[model samples]
Target: MELKKEFTDLEKSAVKLTVTVSQKDVAAAYAETLGTYVKQAQIPGFRKGHVPANILERKFGEGIKADTVSDIIDKALNEIFENDAEKANRPLPYAEPVMEKMPELDVAKDLSFSLTYDVYPKVDVKNFSGITIKEPQVTIGDKEIDEELKAVQERNAVVIDKKDDEKVEKDNIVTINYAELDENGNEIAGTKREDFVFTAGTDGTFYRIDDDVIGMKKGETKTITKTYAKDDKNESLAGTTKKISVTVTAIKIRNLPALDDELAQDVSEKYKTLDDLKKDIVKNMESAKARRIVEIKNNDLLSQLVEKNPFDIPSSMLNAELENRWYSMAQQFQTTPEQLEKMFSSAKQTKADILKEWAGASEKMLKSRIIVDNLIRARNISVTPEDVETRYKEIADRGGMSVDEVKKHYEDAKAKEYLIDDTKEQKLYDELYKEVKTVKGDAMSFADLFKGESN
Candidate 1:
């Protein structure tokens, strides 16, 4: 169990650990390993478990040596890393310790091996305080409330099926099947869809082909070449023109309910009148606007902190983050990473190209993350029971749920831990804001500020 250890510094927060075991232990381990093989050996001209060590060596010496070396290294690493000591030197959870070189097992000499692994980079954040950030002022009033009300009314709209002979029209709900064609005007495999429904010019059919589907009656099909803008929201269709054959299957009219107190009551029991709904909408929108402002503040501060504090992100960390982004992009395209590769290949882009394009942003994200972690740890910021309770109450008040219900929703141990950690991080940032100067930037509306927010 006795060992000698040496730590050598490497680039990108990596450390080389050298572990040495005496010749006596190596000889003993070799003997023990040979004995295991001796018990199970079935060499010709020898009885089982009776094969001589020298003969076994001639047959399986290399295998025995490799196994002994692996066992020794595993034991050595376990004894060191399992001590819960030297938190800074610990390997990151996602990164495994890579051996610098595979050592040969020799009973005549001491066992010596080295490992290189990534740890968290030493974070010395600079200029994280006393920075001025622009705080956008967004107005949440009757206009915002009315927009939200309109959405709620839309959700409560009634859909009525039109006659079989009815033709698709603007603002009419239509169900259509569509497929993309290649240069030969043939339907490419895996491009066909059926039973797709959307409101023309409103909900937007597949690829926003509302205009192409209009004026077509049920069971009618037409092939049209549609060109998408360079900045189209759907990345797959952006800057590309494809032939789409759309067949309108059904048409319906959406009847929006009257915007009055009765409609408000039907939407939610908490709103007895239209005025009550408007008041609640205002309150919710204000809360959302405030949350969005805080997010903007945090992002601005983090961006500044990342620039002020420059450090190398461990390659493993950056690679992991880029991998996550790649998978996310694949998900956005509704395809697998393997397929995504082919798609990019067709465009003359390689995986390396995409990863190189994303590396800067990924590294910046990691740097900002490290800064947040270091600041919180240095400040000893944490969440108390009261903090969690207050958060639960706020959520319940906003969602029209009881405090008990909110608590029950987050009752899972992992969920509770996540809540606590999130609250703790927010608390650290809240204290950080005290040293920051917030200046009014520009007047914007709630919708513009929270454009992509789903909730």
Candidate 2:
């Protein structure tokens, strides 16, 4: 086949490709298509594979010509794209080539057409060194240690049935049957739960009615009306007013074990004494706080770097990032895209609304990734085979699998490449982290450190 090609650079990291095939190639492809039809031709009046050429053409002339045209175009494009030189000029992986215009198919003349698609943008990362970031100083006080100990005690507490006249109290366990009621006090369908267990005065209890349940005794039934805040975590119930009927089926009290070496032994065999447990808790808390500080610093560094050196992102890549975000959110809800759409419909929200909400964050994430990749290339950061082997060993020990088994899993899932990428990114971040100038800021309490930022 003979062909002529031209490339045109377009805006927003897009390219236009035009190709013209020689008339000789078109005629040859047409003749080849006709020969195949002749050998396989079957007609009513003739034996299979014995139909005359003129009769077959007369019967299926237009269809054969159309198929021939499609075959020729596919072959020509494949040949051009498969060439090493032309392959280098192809579109980005996530963007498909869209036909700009279709040429008229004719065997007597050369074929010409054009396509347009997005390509990877060129980025130059700069000013990544000597960046200043604030690192939070977190201090774990005695109060914090006491709080952690209390949590451990609560986890190990045993539940005992309440007396006949005992009422619900703070920190007591209660099991109840409840249902939501409409304005007219009618039970709403699909809004009822049987044997729901929760601790009084704790966060996340359905309806936040700890005060209302304080005086309710065992086997007592009561109905209460409450209005939830506009920004409630449960979007469906947010800004809504409804009555809920509750029947306390059971009331129980927690018997916390005395805080001592005995309690430490009950909590974990690794703890030899109460002091040992406290030391371990402090070490773990400090390590977690250090990690959080590093995360915040890295985020600040990236944001500053992006601000200093900005570039246009390929629209195709940004759109793909948004799609991945949506898919992940849907997975968390354990539903398909269509079902999620129906859910949003019930909540008076649309897919567009969700996408709009996530657009800014998605774009920022994509931009950060692109910048990091560029920096990795610029700095020549990479992962060695030794790094991969070490990672494999760590995974093997943690998962209780042999190194060879873990290696096989990574290879079978084609995850080794991703592991390499992750290793390279970490290495690059470490290198950048060393150049950062850390400034001492105000101290953050242990509670604030773990509370995290609000959405």
Candidate 3:
């Protein structure tokens, strides 16, 4: 079908597309639709295939005209969108074109309608190179090594049953049966659990009972009333006060392994001696610290770049980003969006409030992404076949899998495309890093560095 197209730019990265279909096209579409109905449509008091054209038209003329008009519009729009010459008028991937006006179906005359949609903003990145960024200089000290060694020892520790007279203390694993009680001290239905275990005095334990668990001997029963804060992690119990009855059934203590050659052997076969384990720990810590430093530098550089180059983002893209972030947060909390919304309802928090709190970070992330993508395109950054092979080898070595196996895992087209894109981004970052002047700043401890803090 032949079509005449006109484009109009609207505010906020929106565009209006007006398309007119010729009368000849509409007539052709109507005839094609009519022929199909005549050939297959059933009618009373007549042979199915022998229905008269006038009768069919009289019975279904309006329906045929509407379907034909819709078909013509769809065909014209598809042609305009798919044509390479019309790429400039295409909407952004996240934006769906909505019909602004629906013209009445008219087979005898030309048909025209307008569609409005958001498009990606044209970005021109400036001042992206030669910027000064601070790089954290981190070193693995003995204190870090000792802490890591202690963690390792703890991991290999054995759990031993506590003595009969022993009381629960910090780091002791206690198994208990618990139930929520009403004001009358009656156990609430469906609120009981048996063999619930947690370590005393640890954040992993329930906030209401973490401190209360301390000094409780085995077989002891206690009931306490606690009020949970509004921001409690347990959404169901948040901002509610309840009485909980707890009975400690068992207590166990962790016996940490001695920091010696025997412990090293138990930790890993690669380490035959304590010094070997320490050396490996130091190497791993240094590598992790180096990676963290590069990550911080990259984030800082991108943040600066985004700040220098600002543009209005499409609302659709921002909404998509926010949705992804919201879903991710809900997943972390083991809840659904509906459940989270309901939980917030009690606290008088609206969806707008949540969006307002997260919009700043989400917008920053999108700005950084757009800037990096534009820079990569401007510089013609690409990943070579050798880059893919090298990446495959690296992944294979890390996963203890064959290179062919790793390649097989990424045989899907999308996986390969993602790998290529990731490689290109890395190359772009490396080039930009060279252009930036980085100064070594104050040294950071392992704890601070791994915790994602920068000087």
Candidate 4:
């Protein structure tokens, strides 16, 4: 047997193997050794197992010969791989080798087959000292705490229809019967609602309500026209400009409880007074702010690191990450791919289009992960059994399940891989804190961080 190897790409190789059929191979009837006839052999025609080997071959010669050829090719390929493991470098059964052409053979000639595959790329870790980036400074302030508390109150606030003579004001709850028609004046399905709530001056809920509705009194009716964004959460009304006739049914305004001990008790029983709550809130707020600052810094630092040490990323992995991100977004928005595409039709962004655009981000994300993984391995990061157990228990507790149940849920290899990756990421962050320089900047409230970004 003779084998030849060729390099087709950085991680791809092709092997051509030629084997001369020996006299012993044919004499021993190697097809029998390959277990093809174990369950089908017969010594005679009287009983199934009574048929003779020569008779079996003569009757099924073509089929048996085909199986014999496959066996020979497989065995020869294994030999070729084992002989050239080191020469191939990073190695595994990468992919099914594409046979460009097969060698022609007769009873007296050698048989040959060509196989091709791709191996894992070899990764080299280097230049760890120069990676640098800017970290955004975030500070949770009294204003942020107040804003969050207000949001909590709003979540708990009740809405009711306004009285017949009541006038609508900013933040005053307004309920109405509304129907929207397209340019044809045909009533659009799903564009009509008998009950919809909008608070004036706050972002108009559902379709944007005009300022004219804000100052209107109850029992009044008006027809308004407006355009809704293509990305609106309401699927049926998005991306459509329609004339809507709305009748002011009633307005129920929210009156927040005074920010005092009562408010403190409403949030949690741990606080006896508003001052006590404020102290705890401020502490929690500061911790949250610090975490946000760390996260921003982390992203900036990693981005810089990736920029400095850029290399070719595996296209397959990048595409996988993009799909994963798209699925995540779809799940968060509580909509299907088709529904989202319909809602955002004007934008021409189907899920596939969005994912294609995100490919670069996905590549960068995976590059960052690769760097973090290298760092973990280089530092010989160790995750204690206790640490895993404690973390598992914490997650289980949050999920309202026992640790054993959580362990059972992670029985698959993929789950274990995720847990290990999480552990490594955490360790990398800790290591980064020690190596990276952090500059303090003027602290900004969480609201300031997200306000312009959200709108």
Candidate 5:
């Protein structure tokens, strides 16, 4: 295992490791390899375990040399990495060392070879402390409470089916089969829907066909043309006029519960009065506001943190991330990655093209992840068993599950590890909140505050 090793720096956090094993070790290794092949050989003219070295070499010299060289390289790398004091020079897990070239083996001389691979980047976070971030100032008042209560009332509303001949009217539930039409009046593919139920005159339909559906009777079909504004929120329909064939199949009326003590009692067992329900709603909204503000804070500050700290991510890491995302997207479509690739192929594109398009976003994701990890390490943040127990209880309370159930759910080692890591990350966020200063941003309503986010 006697060898000389040298490292050469490369771009994108890459390193080239050049290794040289001495002539004595090479001779010994080659001899040992050839001896094993000679004993194992069963040449047609020779008995098993009795093949002559000269004959075996004549038949398998190239193969012996290749094996000897590969074995030497593996031994050298294992020796170097296992005993190395500096941890940062270790290759990234996803970065397999690629041999620069197969070395020319010579037993009489030293065996020399080289490998190039990526290592984790060294990061020095700057301007991350004492920074100012803005948080939106939002108030959850009677208007917000009323809006939420209206949704609650609708959820508890009673639905009465109308007669088959009844016409669609405002505030009545309508079920229709709809399809968009091309210029030739043919139904366009991927735009057909059936049994789409929505309340009329409430902007409930995705295509905004509420007004068009009014006055249409059951079993009635009509070709309706609707013009969408240039700045329409629905991107596909914006700035376009499309003809849709709508067939009314069913109609019904919704009778919403009145906002009173009875409705409050029906909504949940804890509330005895409508005012008590409103107070509970305010408390819940306040809790939601605090949680949403944390998200906004992260969007405001962590983005700045990522920008302030710049580091190169190894190409191997980036590629692995991109591949993970590709599979994730394929899973979202409920298709296998191979099938997804075929779909892209039909469009004259390859999986590589899609991966290339996602490289920038993936790189940012990796970079931010590395920065936060570095910060977490530097701060020496950790999660204790008590912290994990508290987190489990919190999850159980939120999910309406028992503490034992939550524990059982996270019983697997990987799940338990994830929970620990999650708790540590939350702790990191807590520390970050304490470290940074928050200023009031623009005042917005609850709806506006959560506009781009999922409810």
Candidate 6:
């Protein structure tokens, strides 16, 4: 096997490997196959296991050649990675090599095939000594607790329709009639609509609700106009201005429950009193705050790391990330893209549109992930069996299943892949933390961070 790398445009590297399998080696490989077949042979004129070598050759000769060829190709690839463990730095093989033009075997010569692959640009990571990041001191103050209690109350609140004479305000849900249009005042191809429900908050369902829906009262009818973003998931209505005439049919407001023993029971059975619930909330907030600080510091260090160690990412990897992102978003919304567009006819997306929108960010994310993986490997960080088992158990418990049952359910290939990927990310985070200069921040509370910034 002869291997060489050639530099190409755009900081890419192409590796060309030539593999030669001599006739002698091929014959030896075929001989073992012939021997096995001969032992089980049953020819027309001979007893089982008594077939002649020449006869067997004439019968199974082509089959032996095919098997030999497959074995050689598999062996070549295995040797390529085994020859140098550092092949991980190479751009992962984007496409399998084409071998239709490979050399054919002759009576006494060798057969050969050429293999090609692309390599990602090299990244030299350094200069970690002077790095400093502010760890957003987290504190659980009384005000934060009060705000959290308010949120909890809201979550447990029941919504009731307001009286016809009552005025509508923020946090109230309003029913309206809306339609989207083009610049020419002609109704946009996909924007015509009748009645729609919209909340007054920044929830994704109500696009630009703050500017259009808030401050309006029940029984009031009004026309509101706004520009929709070009990349808005709605393919037809995107980049268009539309008129919405809303006749508020009814208004509904949240009615928070009192913070007492009943509220405590509503939140969780583990707590018996309001104070007990508050203590539990505080404990959860503290843990969450600590985690947020760690996450923020980690992201800061990684962003700096990417800048210090620059390298080109493979287009294939970037494409994969884009697809993963789309799938993730789809899962979050609980529907496929096609279904989403059909359901939210005004705010659905085409596959091509989604790809175009996510391509740039996906590419950057792919490059960053590559850097994180390489750094973790270079530092010799490892996730142990115990770590994996502990995580698996925790996941099983959260999923409401026994660990043994979870293991059995994930005994297949796809589940193992998910487990390994999850474990690798966890292990990589630990490796990164060790490399950075960490200063313990103040004990922060989750309530402070969880509250809406403006609120």
Name the top TM-score candidate.
1
lDDT of 4 at 64: 69
Ranking by TM-score: 1, 3, 2, 5, 6, 4
What is the C-alpha lDDT profile of model 5 across 341-455, one tens digit per residue?
7645533457898898789977876787777777787889998889988998988766557999999999999999988887777888888878778888899999888887732
Residue-level error in angstroms, candidate 5, position 11: 2.1
**Sorted on lDDT, highest at the top, how do the candidates line up?**
5, 1, 3, 2, 6, 4
Candidates in order, TM-scores: namely 0.88, 0.75, 0.81, 0.63, 0.73, 0.65
Expressed as tens digits, the lDDT of each residue in 307-334 for candidate 2 is: 8777777788888887887788768655
In model 6, residue pairs whose N, Cα or C atoms come closer than 3 Å (at least 3 residues apart or on different chains), thus clashing, are: 91-120, 138-444, 139-444, 285-446
Over 4 Å off, model 1: 44-47, 93-97, 189-198, 202-207, 228-239, 332-335, 340-357, 452-455
What is candidate 4's local distance difference test score?
A: 0.63
When 3 and 6 are scored with TM-score, the better candidate is: 3
lDDT of each: 0.83, 0.80, 0.81, 0.63, 0.84, 0.66
Q: lDDT of candidate 1 vs native?
A: 0.83
Task: Tell me, by lDDT, which candidate is best.
Answer: 5
**Better candidate by TM-score, 3 or 5:** 3
How does candidate 5 score on lDDT? 0.84
lDDT digits (tens) for residues 293-411 of candidate 3: 87888888988888777777878989998888777766754567766565455445666678777788888888888887878878899889999999999778655579999999899
Note the clash tally of each candidate.
0, 0, 0, 10, 0, 4
Error of 2 at 341 (Å): 4.3
- For model 4, give the RMSD to the true fold: 7.4
- Give me the displacement of residue 440 in model 4, in angstroms: 2.9
Q: Over 4 Å off in model 5, which ranges?
A: 1-4, 22-28, 75-87, 93-96, 153-280, 333-361, 393-405, 433-435
lDDT of 1 by residue, 1-455 (tens): 56788888788988888999888888888888999999999988999999999998999989999989887877777887777776677788888888878998879999999888999888876575557889989877777777898898888999898887888888898888887777888876555667887788773654678877778898888998988898977555678887888888889887899999999899888789999988888887878888899888788888887777777878999999999999998786566887777666543457788899779878887898888888877888888889999999988988889999999989999999989988988888878778778799788888788766532
Q: After superposition, how far is residue 211 of candidate 4 from its true place, in Å?
A: 7.8
Ten residues in a row with the worst lDDT in model 3?
339-348
